[model samples]
Target: MSKPVTDRLLTALQAIQESQGAVSDTALKALSQARSEPLYRLEGLRSFYPVFREIAGAPHRLQICRDGPCRLKGQALAADLQVALDGRQDLDIEMVSCLGLCDCAPASALNETPGPLPDASTVIEWLDNAHWPIPVATNNLQRLPTDPYPGVDCRYGAIKAWRDRPAEDIIREIEAAGLQGLGGAAFPTARKWAFTRAASGEPRTVICNADESEPGTFKDRHLLENAPHLVIEGMLLGGVVIGASLGVIYLRHEYHQARRRIEEALATARGSGVLGPDARGPGLAFDIELFVSPGGYILGEETALLEALEDRRGEPRHKPPFPTTVGLHGGPTLINNVETLAAVTTILARGASWWRAQGRGEHAGLKYICVSGDIKTPQVLCLPWGSTVAEAIEGCGGLSDGRNLLAFSPGGASTPFLPPTAADTPMTFDDLRAAGSGLGTGALFVVGTGRSLADVLLAQAHFFRNESCGKCVPCRVGSAKGVEMAESALEHSPAPIEQALETLHHTLSRTSICGLGQVALLPLVDGLRRFPDEPSLKPLKGFTTGAD
Candidate 1:
C-alpha cells in the first residue's frame, strides 16, 4: 500500500498553488485530469494490462519466448497461448524474446512470480492441481505442460513491507536478500548499490541496464515488454536508498515493443506522480527517463553502455574509474541489469527474509532462466536456485523428438559447453562454475544428436568475430584467427586443428582487452575438450597441414 502517484501530485500541486495565493479549483482539476489521462490511456493500450491488474492487482505478466532458436524448437505455442489468453480478464500473455530458457521452450509466468512448476509431473497434472481450471485448446494455443507458479499465492499478499522503515533499512533488506545480478554477471547487487552510496558526490544517478544484446539471451526484453512498471519501481527504490535524483533505463534498439512499453510506463509513472519532480510521500522525489541503445552486443557491457548514453561510440573504456566513480558523463552512477533492478522492487516490497527464504544452499533465492535451442518449449523458467538441468528440461516439456541431449551451453556462447553427463548438475552460478562453466546470463542452448559440435563452434565463433568492436588488437585479430582456425580445422588433420585451436585460444584468452576477446575461444576450447570424437579433421585432396 503505497499512495498513488496521481494523488500525491495533486496534493503537491494544491500546496504549491496555495503558497502562490488563490487558484481556481476547476483549472487545477483540469490540469490534474489532463496529466492523469495519458497514464490511463497508456495502460489501456495493452489489452493484457487491465486483465492482469484485475487478477493480480498489478500488471502481472508472463513472457513466452519467440526468438530464433526458440522458434526452431516449436516455441510458437506460447504465442498461441497469448492470443487465447489475450482478453481473459485473469492472465496477461506476451510473446517475449529469448528468455534465456531457450532450452525450455514455451515458458510463461503467473503474475510477477518467478519459477518452474512448483511440483507437477506434466501439463495436465498442473492444471488439475490448480484452484482454477486452466484454459485448454488442442490447436496451436495449447497451454504449456507446466504450472507457471505453484504452491505460492498468486495474490499480491506475498509482497509485504518490512516492519523497519528507513532508506538504509531498505538497503539492508536488499543486502540480506542475497540477490545477485541476473544480466550475465552474477555480481552481488547490494555491493553495487553500496558503491554508489559510498561514492563522494551529490545528485547521484542510477541506470537500469536493459540493453540486453547478449546472443541467445532475452529475459530483460520480456521484463521490459510485460512489466515495465516493475523496472520503474526498482529504479525508484534504488534512487531512494542511494539518494539518486535521476534514473534512466538504457534499452536496446531491436526491442521496439519493449522500448514502447517502457516509455509508456515512464509517462504513466510521471503523470501519476510515481516518478518525476514530486513523487510519492513527503521528502521523497526521484525522476526516471528512457534512453534507447544503438543496438549492439558490446553496448550491453556497462562501460560501453555509459559511453553510448553520452552519444559516443559504444566501445569499452579502461576501468578503475569503474562506473561507480566516473560514470555517465563523469558522475557517481550506479548501473544494474533490468532483472537485477526488478528484483530490488521485490526485495523492498517483500522483506529480505522472505527473499532469502526461497532457495537452498549458497544460491539463496530464485533465478529467472532463459532457455533456448532445440528444446520442445523454449521459454523463460524461473526456478529456485540449485534446480537441476533435468528439472529445467522437464519444466519445458522435455526435449523435442526424444532426441538425446548431446551438449549444451550453460550460459551464452561466451561460456564453455557442458555435455549430457553434466546436465544433472544444479543450475546455479557456483555449481555451473564448479562444473567448468559460468552461468553467464543463464542462457541454455541444448544441442541434440544431429547438431555437429564443430559446426556449432564455427557459428558461435563467427558471431564473436562479427561482434568484436576492434577497439583492441587482441580481440580483432584473435577472433578472426579463431574463426579461420575453426573453419580450417574442418578440412585439415587432427594435429593442424589442434595447433590452430591452441593458437587461437592462447591469443584470445591471454591477450584480449575485454571479456569478449578473453572468452571468444570458449566454445572451441570447451567443445574440443569435452567432445574430442566430434572434431574429425580430415585433410582435403590438395590441402597440406601448413598450407594457407
Candidate 2:
C-alpha cells in the first residue's frame, strides 16, 4: 500500500477525469510533484498507455471498443461516431480494444469511463450531456459454486473457514484441490503460491487479474458483477499464505460494473474484519486493493502488468526471474486470474474431494467456460472438465437455428479455430493443449458453417497486429505481415499460408519474449492444418523461409 509512482499518477488521473472528463494541466503538474519526477519523465509515462490522454483543452474524448466482439458488429459504431464527430474539433475519438463489454456488442466509454453504448442514441446523449446511463445491479449472489443458482447459503464461508486455520494448512487444501491458473498458462495454482512463499523477499504481494479483455470472454465480468466476494476471499486467503500485506486487483477499464462491485466487496470485507490488520489471525497483516489497467493488450501478461503497475509502459520483461520469484515493485508476488481465485475460494470452503468429483479423468473440476458467438443464447456455464465442446454449446440451446458450428476458438482469440471434428475433444487444460489449443480463460467463440476460415484468421491477424507491444520484432512485424497476407489472399493467391506461419513460428517461438508472439502460433498453424481449403489464404512464393 506504499504510494508508488503508479498509484500516484492513477489517483491524480482518476480524480481529474471524474471531475473534468480529461487529465488537465494542473492535475498533471500536481502528479509530477506528487511523484517528485521531472515533467518529461511524467510525459513519457502518460504517452506510454494508449488510453492515457494529454487532454489539451479538448471538450471530450470518445473511446470505442475495436476488439473482436465489437468488430463482429462491423464498423457501424465507429462510422456513426465519425459522422457525429465530423467537423467537431472539440471532440477527439479513438478506436481502442476490448472494453470488457463484449456481452453488449459495440461498446464504448466516455472519457476514461466504461459503459455499454448499445446504440447511436446513447452516444448522442453522451455527446450532448457528457454522461451516460449505468445498468442496475440486480444479480444478488446467493449461490456458491457447488449448488445451482442461489446455491448453498454459505455467504463468505471461505473467509470464515480460514479465520482460525494456519496459513500452511490453507495452502495445503488449495494444492489438494488440483486447481490450476485459469489465465491461459494453466500453471498449478498451489505451486505458484508455494514459490512466492519460499522466495526471498519482505512484504510479499498478491494480485487479482480481472483485466479480462480477450474477445468473446466475458465470464470474468459475470463473476465480478455477481460473485465479487468469491474472488476477494481467494485473494485474502492467498495473501495470508504468502505473508502479503498488500494485494491488488489489476482490473480492465472497460468493466465499470465489475469495478463498482469489487469496490463494494472490498468495503464489506474490511467492515467485516476479513481484510485489514490480521485478517486471518494475529500478526497476519493482509488487505486487497484494485488497480485499473490503462488499456493495452500486452498488459495481460503478468510481468508486463507489473511493469505498468510500477508506472511504466505495459511491456514484457525478460525472464529467468519470473513473477513468483521477483515481482510487483520488486517483491515476491503471486497473480491469479479472476476465475482461478474464485475457484480457490470454493475449493477452500468445499474440500478437494468434492471438487475432484465434478470432472472426469484428466479434467478434475468445473470449468467456467463462456460459450458465445453464433449461439441462440450466449452464456457462462460451469461445465464439468472433460466435457465435450459440443456439450457445452448445447447447454445454452445449441447454435442459432440451422447454423452448424464450423469452427471455434476453444479458449478466446488466442486459441486455434478447431473444426467440428475437434468439438468432440475434451475441454480440459491438458486435453485442449493436446488438441492444439489451450483452455485459455475458458472462453469459446463458435463460428457458424460456411463462414470463411480465412476471414476469421484475417480478423485475428488484425487483432494481434494492432495490439502487439512492439517490444520484439517477430511479433510486431510478423503480426503486421500476417494481416497483409490475409488481406492479399482475399483477392489473390501467392504463397502457401501454412509455410509463412511455420516460418514465423520458428522465428518468434521463443525469441519474441512473451505470449504475444507465442499465441499467434495457435490460430495460424491450426488454421492451415484444420482449415486447408480456406480461400482467404493465398499461395505465394518468397513469403516463407527458403525451405518451404
Model 1 spans > 4 angstroms off: 1-165, 280-284, 491-495, 535-548
Q: What's model 1's TM-score?
A: 0.70
What does candidate 2's lDDT look like per residue over 34-98, in tens digits?
76877776676666676555564556666777766566554566787678666766567777766
Whole-model lDDT values for every prediction: 0.63, 0.74
Residue 252's lDDT in candidate 2: 81
- Model 2 spans with C-alpha error above 4 angstroms: 4-7, 24-30, 56-62, 75-93, 110-154, 491-497, 538-548
Could you estimate the TM-score for every candidate?
Answer: 0.70, 0.89
Worst 10 residues of 2 by lDDT: 539-548
Count backbone overlaps in model 2: 5
- Candidate 1 at residue 299, lDDT? 71
> Looking at model 1, which ten-residue stretch has the lowest summed lDDT?
136-145
Clash totals for all candidate models: 24, 5
Give the Cα error of residue 53 in candidate 1, in Å: 41
